[model samples]
Target: MKIKGLSTIRQKLMVFVVLLCGVLLGLVWLLNVWLLESFYTHKVHTDLQRTADAFSLLIQKYETLEDPSQPNGISPDFYSAVQQPEYTTMLLGKCIEIADANYNCLLGNHALSSGQCLLHPARTTLFGDTGLPSWNNKNVLAYRAQTLADGDMYFTLNGQNGMRQMVVCKNVADRYTVIVSTDLERIGQAGEVIGQQVPLIAAVLLAVSILGAYLFSKWFTKPITELSHAAREVAKGNYQVRVREPENADELGQLARDFNTMAAEVGRTSELQRDLIANVSHDLRTPLTLIKGYAETVRDLTGDDKQKRTDQLDVIVDETDRLSGLVNSVMELSKYSSGTMKMEPVRFDLAQLCDEVADRYRNVCEQNGYHLDVQTDQVCMVKADPDSMSRAIHNLLSNAIHHIGEDGYVALHVKPQADGSTRVEIIDHGAGISKEDLPYIFDKYYRSRADAGKVGTGLGLSITKAILISHGYAFGVDSELGKGSTFWFVAAAAEPEKSAEA
Candidate 1:
C-alpha cells in the first residue's frame, strides 16, 4: 500500500536526520566505553610495574648491607627503609617472616602453627612445585620469572583496587636477596576516580554527537526545505514561486534556478492557452454564424432571383468549408499537444516536396494577380514525414499568395544552408505585419494587417508551426512593416538514402 503524505520531501528529510542522530549517538557511546576501558587498563598496568620496580630496588639496597658467606640477616638500612615516613609498607602492620631457601627462618620468629611463616608460605609456594607465583594468592596477582640479564628469578606481587593496582617483589641475586612491598591504595584510588567519571564523560559525548548531528542536518537541509515550500506554492498554480538562491554556483542553487525558469515558462504557457481558446472561439463562431445566416436566408427567400440564391448557397458552402478547416486544425493541434500525433517518416527529396507545395498555390496566386516565383538550385533528401513537411511548405506559400496585393509578387525559395540543413522561405511583396503583432503571428486566429478582409479562419500558420515543431524542424517568421513578411522553415540533414533507415 502506498503511504499517504509520506512521499513528501520534508517528511523524508526529517526521518533521515533523526535516524542519523540516533546512529551517531550510539557510536559515541561505544567509542567512549572503549576509550575509557583502554585508558584505565593501561594506567593500572603501568602503576603495577612501577610498584614492583620500587620494591625490587629497596630490597637490593638492603641485601647489600648483609653478609654473603654466612646466613644473611635483615640489614640496618632495611629497618631504616621501613621507618621512612613517605613509604607505604604492607609489611608494617601485617605479620611476616624471613626464610631461607630450605624454608628455615633465619630472622626473628613470626611463624605460624605449621612451623612456617605466613609470608614464608607465600614466598615458598611462589617458587615451588606449582610452577606459579602465590603472592598472598587469593588477594593478589604475582609472577616469578628468571631474569634475562642475570639468569636469576624475581618474584612480583600485585593487587587491584578500582581499575588500578600495584605490584611489589624481590629480585634474585648472586649471594643475597630480600623481600619488600608497597601498598597500591593510592594508585588504585586515582583509577577509581577515573572509572567513576565514565558515565558523565559518556553522557557528554552522547550530547555532543546528537548536537553535531542536528547542526549538520540543519545545514544540509536549509536549501532543501526552501525548495519544498517553493514546489508546494507552484502546485497551487502560483507560477511565480521563486527561491532566493545563493549566488554561488552550487548544485542546490542551480536546481532552484532551473525550477524558477520552469515555473515562469509554465505561467507563460497558461496565459497563451487562455488567449488561444478565446481567439479560437471567436474565429469559429464568426464563420459558423455567417454560414448559418446565409443558409437561413436562402431558405426564407420566397421569390428570389435564381442567381442570387445560387450566390448565397455558394457563400454558405465556402463558409462551411472554412469552418471545417478550422475544426481540422484544432483537432490536429490537440493531437500534437497530447503526443498522439504519429509521423511516418521516410526518405524523400525535399526539393520535390517544396515544388509540389509551390505548385498547389500557383493558380491561386496568378488568379489573384500576384506574380509567383519559384527559386530552387538544389535537391535535399531528408528524413521526414513528407505529408507533414509538404503541408508546412504549402502553408507558407498559401499565406503569401493570400496576402499579396494586386500587381504584387510572391516568391518561394528552397536551398541548402552552410550547416547541412535545407531551408524553405516564402516571401511576399505586400503590406506586412506590425512589429508588436509579429511575435504572435503563428498563434491561432492571428491575422496581420495585410490579411484584412481575407476569408481565412486563421489556423493554417498555427497548424504549420505545430507540425514543424513536432517534426523537430526549425521554423520562424520575419516581418517588416509596409515592406513585406517572410516565413521560413528548416529541415535537418539526415539519411539521403531513405528516412526509414532507422
Candidate 2:
C-alpha cells in the first residue's frame, strides 16, 4: 500500500514538533541509562573514602590517648567513631570490618567467633586466587590487606549475595585498617525509576508540542492563504479584492503590502486601458464619418456646383489629414514610449531652433489672425538631440496655436541660466488647464476638458514629454483655470568655448 505523505504545512509542523520532542527525550533517556550507574558508583566511592579518612582520624586520637609511658595497654573509643553520620551511612546494610596488625577483629558491629579473624573463610576463598595481598593471608580482607601492604588506599568490585559491591580500604596510623563496603544495585534501581517516568513525560510534552505546532502553522499560513485568494480574484479581473493587512512587521507583512500596491496599480492600468479604447474609437469614428459624408455629398449633389464641390472636397481632405495625423501620432508615441527612438545629442543654438520652429507656423498664424512673438536676448547653446528637440518645440507651438484663438498671441522665449543650462518656454493666452486635469496632461490619450473641441490627437504633449525625458531634460507645465498656460523645458548649456571655437 502506498502511504500518503504530509501535504499541508500544519501536518508537517506537527510532525516536526513531535520528532523534536522525541529526540530530546530519547537523549535524556540514553544519558540516564548509559552514564547514571558510573556517576552513582563514583559518588559512593567518594563517600566511602571520606568516611575511611574520618575513621582513621578517630583511631589516631584514641592512640594518642594511650600515653607512651604506659604503652602496654590501649583504650580506643570505637563507640564515638561508629556514631558519626558519615560512618553510619557508609556502614548501613553493608559489611564493614576493622582488623589490627595481628588479624584480630579490633572493632566491628558483630562479635567474632572463637578463632575468627576480620576475613571470613568464604570471603577469603573468593579472593584467594585474585592475586591480591590477601591471596596468601587469610586474616585481613582482600582490599584492607592490599592497603596495609602497600600503604595506598584502593577499592575492588566483587559479587556478593547476587549483588555487586564496592569495597574501599584505608590504613589508620599503622594500628588498624578500615574496610567500607556498599551494594551497587541501588544505583541500578534509581536508573530504573527514571527510565519508567521518561515515556510518560515525553508523551505529555509531545502532546503539548503538537497542539502548539498546529496553532502556529495555522496562524503563519493565514495571511498567505488570504493573499492566494486575493491573487485569484485579481486574475479573474476583479481588481477590487483586498485582504486585511497583517499586523506583523515581518517579511509576510511586507509581501501583503506589496501585493496591495500591485493590485492598485493593475486596477488603474485596467481603467486607463478601457478609457483608451473608448477615446480612440470616438476619435477615429468622427474623422471617418466626416470623410465619408463629405465625399458622398460631393458625389451626389455638390458635384454640379463649383464652390460647393470645392468646399466639400476641402472638408474631406481635412478629415483625411486629421485621421492620418492621429494614426501617425499614435505610432510615434508608441515608438518613443517603447524606447525605440534613438537619441544623438549635439551642441545647438536653442534660440535659433525656437525661431525656426515658430516661423514654421507664421503663415497659419497670420491667416488665423494670431501673432507669433519670439523672444531671445542672446544665443543660448545647449546639448540635445537636434531633431527630437525640434519636434518637441514644434509640438509645443502646435499645442499653443490650437489653444490661442484669433487675435491671441503665442510667445516663444529662450533664456540662458547662470548654471550653464537653457530654459525654453512656450506661452499661450487661452483657457488654461484645470488643476485636476493638469497632472494628466502628459498622459497618453489624455485630454483636458478645456481642449474639448481641439482638432488634434491628445498625444502631442505626451510625445513631447517622452522626447525631452529621453534626452534627460527637465520639462513641465504651469497654468491656472482662467490665466494662460506656459509649457517649459530645460537643457544643459554647451560650453562657451565649444560654441565659439567651433
Candidate 3:
C-alpha cells in the first residue's frame, strides 16, 4: 500500500529517525522500571552483610582479650572500637543488634525507640522485650528463622514493613550472634521519584529528537529537491534550469553533475531542432521554387519552341532530383542516428576503397576546376560495412569539395598507424572552421557562418559521425581558421586470412 504525505524522501527520513529515537528511549525506560528497584535491593543487602561480617570479626578479636572480670564477655577497648565513627557510619541507615546464645541483647546501636529492630525490639533496658512479634507475618519469619537454623552461616529476610534484615548466627568464640537490619523504603522512595520524572524527561528528549530529525532530513534531501525542481522546469520546456553540483564525491553529487550535463545536452538539442527546421525550409524552398517557375515557363512560353522548352524541362528535372536527394539524405541520417541501419561488416583494404571513391569523385572535381589527390602508400585493411563506409567517404569528399581553397586543392590520404589501426583523412584548404565551430561541426543541421551558403544539406558530417560511431571507429577533425581542416576516422586493421575466410 502507498502512504500519502510521505511520498518524498524527507518525510520518510524524518519518520524513520523519530521512530529510532523512540525505540531507544523506550528501552531505557524499560530497564529503569524493571531493574532499578532490584538494583537498590541488592545494594542494601550487600551493606548489611558487610556490617554483620565486621561485627563477627570484632567478636573473634575480643575473644583473645576476654577476662572473666570484664562485663558482657567483651573488654572496654573492644566496645569503644565497635562505636568508632567509621564503624557507626556503616550503620547510619541501619540498626545493629548483638545478642548471646540465649537471645539476650548485649549491644544495640541506632535502634528506633518505637520497637523497629526485629531482634532488639525495645531500648528501655538491657533486658527489654515487648513480647510482640517483630515480623508482621509469622509464616515469613518462621521460614527465614528455619533457614538460619539449618546450618546457614548467615541469612537475609524481607519483612512486610519495607525492611530488609541480615542475620549472622555464627557464635564467634562462643560469644556473640550479630543481626544487621536496614530499611529499604528509602531505595523504594528513590525509585519512585525517578519513575515520576521519566515521562517529563522523555517528552523533552523526544521533542528535541524530532526537531533534529527534521533538520537532518532537510539537509540530506536538499539535492533531490533541487533536482526535482530542475526536472519540472525542463519538462515545461525550460532546458536552461540546473541544480547546484555538490562537492562531495558521493552518489548524490554524481547525480547532480550528470543532471547538469543532461540539461546542457538537452538545451543544445532543442537549439539544433530549431536550426533543422530553418535549414530544411530554406533548402527545400529554393529547389521547389525553381521547379515550379520552370514548369510554368515550359507550359506558357516555351511549349511551341523546341530548344527553349527542352532546356526548361531539363532544369525542372534537375530541380526535382535535387529535392529527391535532400529527402533521401534526411531519411538516411534519421536511420543512422536512430541505430536502425544495420551493418554487414567484412574485411576490405581501406586504401583500395579510398582509391576507388576518389576515382569516382575525380570527374566532378575536374569539372569544378578542383584538384583531387589520392596518396595510398600502404594497403590498410579494416573490417566494416562497405556500403555505409562508401557513403561516409562520399559525404566527406563532397564537404571538402565545397570548402576547397582558391587554388582548388583537396587531398585524401590513407595511412597505417603504428598501432593496428588505419586512418583515412580528407583535407581541404578553404577558409577553415574556427575553434568555436569545430566542436559542433558534426552536429546535425549545424553550419558555420563560413559554409552557410554551401550547396548541400548540413547533415553530411553528422551522417558521417553516426556511421563511424556505429562501426565503433573514432573520428575527429582538426582545423585552424586560416589553415584549412583535416577530417579523419581511424578503424582497427583486419587480417587478410580472416577477410578471405569471411
Candidate 4:
C-alpha cells in the first residue's frame, strides 16, 4: 500500500535517513548486548599473556642470581621491575604465580602467600575426563594439561568457594611457568553497565538523527517546493512569477535556471499574444466599420443616382476585400510560424518571378506617381517553393509601397553571385528603421513609432522571415534612419543541365 506521508521527496528523504541511522544504532546495540562478554574475555586473555611475557623477561634477567634464598627467591631488580607501573597495573587485583619446573614457588602475588603453589600433573587429562583424578577441579586440571601441551592456555575455573575465575597459564624460559588469574565478577559488572547504558545512548542518538533528518529534508526539498509554487502561479496565467536560482552546480540548480528561462519565454510570448489580439481587432474593426457605413450610405442616399451608387458600392467592395486580405494574412502568418505550411521547391527563374510581381503593382505605382524598377539580366534559376516565395516577394513589395510615400520609388533587383547563389533585393527610399528597432523589426505585431498610424498588419516581415527560413534561404534587412531600407534574401542557384548526345 502506498502511504501518503512517504509520497513526497521530503518525506521519503527523512524516512531513508532515519532508517539508516536506526539500522546503524541497532547494530551497535546488538553487538554490545550479545558480544560484549566475549570481547571482554578476549581482552583479559590478551592482558594475561602480555603480563606473563613481562614476568618471563624479568625472570630471564635474574636467572643467574648467585643466592636463590633472596626475598621471594627473586633478585631486587626483578622485584623492582614487577613493582613498576606497567607490570603492577596489569597484574593488579589478579593472582600471579611463577613456579620452577619442580612446582616450587619462585615468585608469586598475594594468592601464593597462602602457601599454595600451582603444580603440573605428570600425566595430563582432557576436560571432562572421568578416568583421571588429578587436580581437585576438573576444569583447572583440563586447562593445566592444555597449557602444558599447547604452551599457553586460557580458561575459566570455579574455585571451591563457587566463585568463577578467568585464568591464563604459559610456560616461559624453559624453567618457569607463569599463571595469572582474575575474578569473573568484573566481566559481569561490565555487561550490566552496557545493558543499562545502551538504551540511553540509542535514545540520544535517535533524537540527534531525527533533528538532522528534518534539517536535511528541508534543505533538499526547498527548491522543489519553490518550483511547484511557481508552476502553480504560471498555471494561473501569471507568467511573471520567477523562482530564485540556486548557486550550486547540481541538477536542482540547473533545473532552476531552466525554469527561469522558460518563464521568461512564456512572458514574452504572452505579451506578443496580447499585442496580436489588439492589433487584429483594430485592423478588423476599421474595415468592418467602413463596409457597414458605406453600404448603408449607398442604400439610404445613392440609390437613385447611378454614378454615385457605383462609387459607394465600390468603397464597400474595397473595404470588404481589405478585411478579407487581413484575415488571410493572419492565417498565412500562423501557418508559416506554426510550421504547418509545406514547401514545394522547384527550379524557378528568380528574375521572372520579380518581373511578374512588379507588373502586378504597375497600375498602383503609376496611379500614385511612384516609380517601380526591376533590375535583372540573367535567368538566375533557384530551387525554392514557388508559391511561398511569390508571397514573400509580394509582401516585401507591398511593405515597400506602404513605406515609400508618393513620388518615392521601389526597386526590385535579382543578382547572381560568383558562389552559384541568387540574391533578391527590394529597395525603398523611405523612413528607415532605427538601430534600436532593427533587431525586432521582423517580430510579430512589431510596429515602429513612425508606422503606428500606417495601414498594414505588422506580420508581413515576420511571415517573410518564416517563409525564407523554411526554404533554407538567408534573409535580412539593412536600414539606416532617413537613408532608406533594403530587404534581401539569398537562394542557391540551380545549375543548367547539358544536352544529351544522340
* TM-scores for every predicted model: 0.59, 0.59, 0.67, 0.58
What ranking of all candidate models by lDDT puts the best one first? 3, 4, 2, 1
Query: Any residue pairs clashing in model 3, and if so which?
Result: none
What lDDT, from 0 to 1, does candidate 2 have? 0.75
Return whichever of 2 and 3 wins on TM-score: 3
Clashes of each: 1, 0, 0, 0
State the lDDT at 123 in candidate 3.
39
**lDDT string, candidate 3, 278-316, tens digits:** 888888989999999999988899899999999988998
Per-candidate Cα RMSD to the true structure, in Å, reads 11.8, 10.6, 9.1, 10.4
Off by over 4 Å in 4: 1-3, 19-209, 235-238, 247-249, 349-382, 405-429, 472-474, 484-502
* Best-fitting candidate, scored by TM-score: 3
TM-score computed on alpha carbons, candidate 3? 0.67
lDDT of every predicted structure (CA atoms): 0.63, 0.75, 0.78, 0.77
C-alpha lDDT of residue 2 in model 1: 52
Task: List where candidate 2 sits over 4 angstroms from the true fold.
Answer: 1-202, 246-249, 302-307, 349-351, 362-383, 404-424, 428-430, 452-454, 484-486, 490-502
lDDT of 1 at 55: 47
Write the residue-wise lDDT of candidate 1 on 1-502 in tens digits.
Answer: 4546667554555555556666765565555544655665555445444544554566566655444543344465564565465444433322232333332333321212233223324433211222234322433222222222243332333423332122333344533223332222343354467666766765776577666656766777788888889889988989888988789899988998888888887886776677657666777778789888888888898227798788888888887787887778778767765669888998777887788777877777667666888887588768898887877787788788767745578898888888778888899877778887788788766665556455556778888888888888888888887788899988898654535665
- Give the true-structure RMSD of model 1: 11.8
What C-alpha lDDT, on a 0 to 100 scale, does residue 152 get in candidate 2? 47
Span of 10 residues, lowest total lDDT, candidate 2 = 121-130
Model 1 scores a TM of 0.59
